[model samples]
Target: MSEELDIPEEGTESLYERRAFVIDKGQEPLRIDKYIQMHLEGSTRNKVQNGIDAGFVTVNGKTVKSNYKVKPGDEIILLSLVNPEHTVLKRENIPLDIVYEDDTVMVINKPANMVVHPGVGNFSGTLLNGVAYYLEKQNPGLDEDSLPRFGLVHRIDKNTTGLIVLAKTADAAAHLAKQFFHHDVKRKYTALVWGDMEQDEGTVTGHIARHRQYRKMFDVYPDGETGKHAITHYRTLERFHYVSLVECVLETGRTHQIRVHMKHIGHTLFNDWEYGGDRILKGTIYTKYKQFVDNCFELCPRCALHAQTLGFIHPVTKKEMLFESPLPADMAMVIVKWRNYIANRKEL
Candidate 1:
């Protein structure tokens, strides 16, 4: 997403416009809601104020109050439901592996190859579609509009499998969103990466932003010149010569944080096609080694990353809640193959 504002041309009416603005260096501090009303056409102070109250407006990805002062270079994003670009969420009968559910929240063990929400190319058959269907079935009179992003507080990549939490009500959504925005949620992931880590454990710190050339990919900016600050702590679990199983704990949640951070430190996740981990980055070039890697790739065709653990304070209960999921079949099988290969080679 660009840090530039999407101001419509003069006299144009865009009631549902999704607006983004990067405050200029010379910008003076102004109340966020007032600033928005001044810049947004066909908008009232009441509407902007209401949007801020409803968490529809964010400053640097964190929800803020109407009175919050917009500082220089602050990235402000405002979303409106009336926008034509926003898709009407469809309720589909897609299957969901729901791990836990209550009146306030729902935790799901998302499968690989499943998009979290409907988008341009994937307008249906997403996790949100199935969640809509399930929520409606559970409560026949449930209002979909009351829930933002279909109750999604956070999301993993499409090919990244594992635990995700969803809010069931507006109040719950607000509470969960606040927690995530403040980085209060505890998230841990298991990743298979190329090469043996130089240290048993270390931290990767950098700013993450969309690549200048590759729009679909993100890159690390250590100079603090661009991107949002992100931090990831990782520790090796087991080393398999050419690959290592590792656990990652995130302090800040940014797009592709773990994947990009791991790659930045020269240990890209195994078979992470987006970050150039699909081919052999380490180990011998023997034909036998190539064949073994090919078989492993066939076993796990997607990125070797899994969100294994999630922890947060329950919106309603106000108590700490934690959940864990085992690795999916494909990843587990590939790990087992690496283990067996190491053992057989040792015997030989």
Candidate 2:
């Protein structure tokens, strides 16, 4: 019998096709590639061998050769970019804000309200579809199979605007994936939280997991509890009495790490719909105060979070690469309003 391990979400780990299996006690010894081909439906021998060559298949948490023999009770794990579902991709000419691109990689400044990948309620019109169309235009006969997951190495939330990197080749994807898995990539986000932070800078360390009651939301767990370890270091940039603008640097990227960590400390991100930031969590209940808060929300309707900076080593060139994006107009305008509000309040 075999069991599949839970795949980590896009932001937490490399969003690859992952499958885990444990060999049955009664099973006879078989070649690793052949065993994988037998267990993974629709997988061909050639494909399995290629995956093995690319260090996608591992036994007992270690990469192995295709000829390695699998024994009973052996744990086998496969991580590939190729999705077994083979979902047909529809290329749409969606406009993309390309920050930088080269032979092996590309950087994009993703806007708010755009889902990064196609899923449940969002099937088409994702960043991936747009990337597919863009890649097709760049290389007329591009074989997507060679560029798994459109070379997406990491992900940001749908409402978060900022820089995301993409690889163009299998080798590049593998290299970049390794970097993300090791937490070597530099990611910095700008967030406006509900309340003023007492400290200028500090780190929030906790284990993060999906909420028990609300499956869509995540909560921070105590250490050694039911979740992956996450760390976020934040520095206050500008403080508005009702809210504070902070720069968050991710030490470990778990799903909703920044949002959850901020909320854990009594300062949920402003306008974060999923975490109750959309409501007026801070500030007075006075009509005038409420109106000002509502106006700020209207200026930036979605989560007031931006993935402002991303830095990584070039997969092929092995050179350090860093990119920065200014806060989106909506978020910037909201900050301006808050600045004005504080200025006016001081005058009074």
Candidate 3:
């Protein structure tokens, strides 16, 4: 089911307003108090717990305890604002899943379908928003131009899941940005695409730019607008009758770099229906799983891209650092179903 909600612009009296949400799978066991504390746009632990206590946070049309666990497909009504005060990013007693942190750098395993930073159509519910809050709350006057953003370095796409780095100081941010610019940050991705392998391994090297007609899309070109150079190395970890499991390595991180380059080749990722994806599954070789893929592409909305690994040098200590995230449930299930299809067809 699709939902289009326009938040009311009222409630200027209180900084935080109200919101509604319907939980998807894998979010079960999430405590009401803790979920609101972490996921609310700019809400703090005290505010969220208070909301829970005040009967504002209703679950399935009833007031529940703060310890109430959110089951899959549960309906949660969050009485909160889109973006609250304490500046762009404020620390609000939220817990971070930090993999590694030092004086200069931090590595985090970002969950899938999460935006790294705030941009258009996303002022909250972002890693950046949370990071900004964390920095402002931790260090007074930390947002000075000399040391902006608690040292956020490189970024990953909203739907593209993976590892990312953060800078606690300005020196670290600048240094890490330089490392990414020089293509020194080691990045890898795991994706299940919809195609048989022409070769067991390959590379797609090109420049990428925003699509001419499709404003939200990116495309590759032989000679396009001063686009940065990018290279992608991929190998079939496992091959099925129709699709292949590919491991992608990035040589340059550009906007939608890997997604665009991968599609530039004949292999569009299994769940990617954006770059010339017809709602009706296309491609002659896809006959095996076309119907199933069509149904999946319609029901499962997220793309199949995932940032499986990230590695870089510590901007301050000059030491190496790494982080990784596992595949999200929906994507994993898609692969599972497709694998079953391949095995049955193989037996036939």
Candidate 4:
């Protein structure tokens, strides 16, 4: 089954433009509203039904109601009648670390302290703005408004430095989006947690959602009570008594998945401010140790996490591709300090 949507240009009063799709021959008869909602990402049942009520949905060139039963070979067209909130997108000449670029996709190594996209309080100085500028410069005829500003197939946190994949064309965006949705993309992260795990390797599974009181943070719902399903598999690479370096492989990508999952299991990522890792979780209460930990925090001010590797199939050429990045200087330096501390302890 295939579905198509014509996305309206930025600053346009027409909320959504014309979009059409042909139902699969093997598809079962179902309500048109339900089918559309299921096919589109970030869509709700109420939104789809409202579109139908506004006479924006048609079947076989006839306007249909929300309850219209869709059969095999049905040609469905939807004229979006809702207003999309305008996002403040600006073009800034920010420097970008382009790892690879082709007609289909571009892989970028995003630095820490950089926001992936502009939203809410952040209206400028983002990776998206920089990328948009780069694309516009590459081709003068490119529509700055129609360009894939939100074409990021995946994103890292503002404070977490890592590799992020972006799609240049709509076809590449859809292909990469499906790969991420199906958990076919390989993602591995390196993190320094506050405690050493008893097991060398383990997996954490829970439902994750925004925290109840702290809207900025996330929490694990173990009983599947709320939020989306999340899983993180981790292996201890090295132990520094109070802190441990671990490699985390994501089975499901949820917001703050590695950070929350590690905190759920009593080993929060080192220097993570939100989940209580900023303060020392292990080690003695001596002034010397306190100063040492504080110095380490100064070395890596943000959460001690890095996206070390990413792998996916090429959207255009249909070839296997993989990329790896070494730990940023801050993370690598902190790890070296920990190794020296362990060495000195052994000598003592």
Per-candidate TM-scores read 0.80, 0.88, 0.66, 0.78
Q: Which of the two candidates, 1 or 2, achieves a greater TM-score against the reference?
A: 2
List ranges where model 3 is wrong by over 4 Å. 1-95, 144-150, 223-226, 277-291, 298-300, 346-348
* TM value for model 2: 0.88
Alpha-carbon error at 116 in model 2, in Å? 0.8
Best lDDT goes to which candidate?
A: 2
lDDT of 1 by residue, 48-84 (tens): 6766887778899999999999988899977653322
- Per-candidate clashes come to 1, 0, 10, 0
Q: Between candidates 1 and 2, name the one with more favorable lDDT.
A: 2
Which structure is stronger by TM-score: 2 or 4?
Answer: 2
By TM-score, highest first, what's the ranking?
2, 1, 4, 3
| Location of the lowest summed lDDT over 10 successive residues in candidate 3 | 8-17
Ranking by lDDT: 2, 1, 4, 3
Who is ahead in TM-score, 1 or 3? Answer: 1
Candidate 3 vs candidate 4: which has greater TM-score? 4
1 against 4, candidate with superior TM-score: 1
Q: In angstroms, how far off is 88's CA in candidate 4?
A: 4.7
Cα lDDT tens digits, model 2, 198-297, are 9999999998999999999999988887888788999999999889999999988887899999999999999998999998987776799889888988
Candidate 3 C-alpha lDDT tens digits along 1-348:
212144432222122234666766655477878876766555566656655664556787787888888777667765453332224443334355677766666777776567665556665677765665666666666533322233455667666766777777645654565466556877889987766778888899887767888988888888545455667899888876566789999876667776788778877776665765434333444554567877666545666777788887776578777777787776677778777776776353
